[model samples]
Target: MRGATAWSSPIDPMAAEFQVPVYFDYLATFSWALSGAIVALRKRCDIVGVFVLALLTSVGGSILRDGIFLQRTPPVLTDPVYLPLITLATLLIALLHQHIIHLQVVDKLVSTIDAIGTPAFAVVGMQLALDAGIPLPGVILVGAVSSVGGGVLRDVIVREIPFILQAGQFFALVVLLACIVFLVLTLALQVATVHAAWATIGLFFVVRTLTIRYNWQTRPLLRDEDH
Candidate 1:
């Protein structure tokens, strides 16, 4: 409980009851929206398409995880803040598309943002599943889904394969590992705190960065033609 006080209280209780986790959610949403917008611009999508993709990438995972999987209304549908945040992200991307597209650092920026968001969303999903009293496997599933489902949806919309199913990157695996680590710390060790969540996010970011740097990949099964 040492670091708990630093994260508990909202500055404006009347205006919004935003907590630390909600802040994480907002960060993840913004990062994913930016990535989606970049992809839309890369694909030569119209402004409408860019906005749609940004919205989908920002809130799509939460919708699938909470609404479809958990059988409840998603926060994006109910929360007033989320829509405005995504709208702002979309408009920023629209205005800066020309500059962003020409930048050599765009890929790195997207990858870094995605790396940061994935673990945050994964921890959020695990926390929700734990609060719902879901089983261990269910918690892990929801966590992974919450981390990558939006990116998958965005890629599918643009006719590209989901990054999780692709050959190179251990992106989804990092999310799963982060979920397991978080649950182990909170449930098994009984150390549930905001610090634990932050630790999980840090671990995930380190692992993901190493994976990308080393070009680590999941091994594929042998093809039929090999026989």
Candidate 2:
């Protein structure tokens, strides 16, 4: 498939066709890495742990996508720019985390990054799946995995419950919805892929941010007798 091989090298951000999506993927990687690094610091992990989480959180989804679905070399290993970019993000968080931790906006910043990165990765994964001729259901699954697989892995590594499994807040649900919308726009309505991707990313980011701002949450199936 076209996307299966596109990650071997950095593409020109200004190039037409796949430009915006590719660039968005890079930005999403850095955002995820930064978020992971911050979590590592908060968990009192050493530098190695910080780097490990940062790198994994940035590319774990892609790895899962390629390994399990595409059966290709994961971009995290082949793409020259991915590792260095993740390293830069990790370094920034590792060095400035102490100062940033005291800031009132830190939580907001993390939410903002996650909000942006989630849809960015999701749409990109959807596009790749389409290019690979994957069926609609499989495309949606790939997009969802590309969106939240990293966070799930990160939480597992830290011995915490995965955010998607937690009752509070919409996480993977947002990604699933975004993927569905993108597919509807591009497939059903026949919209251009790039335009649909951007629209999905913007809409997802806004909706995700609002969920965080309003503290929107899901309830578990069973009621707590004590409560």
Candidate 3:
């Protein structure tokens, strides 16, 4: 007990640390894992390769994150439930890849999931860093990295342009908005972070869906060649 300030349990909403963040992290990580499986099989990888890609894509960034924060082995590896869940997700995607590709809502699903992942991961990262007593800006930086880390790794592994860099997309924009909402509500305004987190989720879903529906995009830098 450090003076009067004992570490609060995660069950307390106001507590700085949350235990189930790993579970949420799993959801955030699934897209990359599934994408790995899809791209691997598409590239004609063997069974070993598929699972290898799955494991790497799902947990690589988390491993790197833990290493960065000096946590050994990564929580996803130490935790028993996460691997099975990721395995199930990858298997489902592998088996149903055909159906997945054909879904008219597939684009929407990716957008929705990426939206959820941003706030979920970012808020969790922020809380973790805060619990460890890091400064706010550092917390924000780490949070942003956690929010998009796996997806960036996944895209690079699959030899595709990272979704964040792809023009005409809302991928990183969702995460950026999420991070801002988290930092503002939790740090600056001293409001309920959980509610603020969900607000970001709703905000991302609405804005992303609109962007997709309206074919929205920020135009590239102009050149004078045509003019």
Candidate 4:
């Protein structure tokens, strides 16, 4: 019974102390769900497909981060808010599909929303890993997975290559760099504050947005003739 009390504790100190991160986590979920729903619409999928993509895009990375990496219950199972939010996103997208499809800015808007979510999730994952006493590499891995895992799953499910594998946009690189910067600031430099976390997020958002706006891309490794 020595460790029983610790195991049965009802409140997690980390969860209670970080209200802002929790709020941003849910916001990221909604943003990611919206992106997936838009993709579903682009594919001419029905309402059910939209729901599936939304759910997957919103929670898929967290599922892997928690269930597979951390060996804990997935947040989608423990948190009641995720499903309702995803459902709401699906419904809203369905309602606005006609107008959304016609808007020339739709692609840019979706990309921006997705970019907003990436750094938030990356910070969340880094904090969680640090709290769990994971090592530096594991922390970075968790952060990267939390940021891009869901999008990768969404793309794979839709039969498209994952964005990270594509030679452009610095998408996955942004997540990795952000995570590394966060770990350096908070762990190595001993600056343990939410502000540091937000700084990392801001850096990621700006760099990612600039890359998108400028059409920056990694140089292609193989030319058509070389291949």
lDDT of 3 by residue, 76-111 (tens): 766686678678866787778778776758655665
Global lDDT of each candidate: 0.78, 0.81, 0.65, 0.81
Which residues of candidate 4, in runs, are more than 4 Å off? 1-20, 225-227
For residues 39-136, write the lDDT of model 4, one tens digit per residue: 89999899999999999998999899888986668888887889999999999999999898878687777678677788888888766666666667
TM-score of 4: 0.90
Instruction: Name the lDDT value of residue 169 in candidate 4.
Output: 63
Worst 10 residues of 4 by lDDT: 1-10
What is the lDDT for 35 in model 3?
Answer: 61
Error of 2 at 204 (Å): 0.6
Model 4: which residue pairs collide? none
Candidate 2 C-alpha lDDT tens digits along 53-107: 9988989998998778866668888768899998898788877887997786876
lDDT of 1 at 157: 89
| Candidate 1: stretches off by over 4 Å | 1-20, 223-227
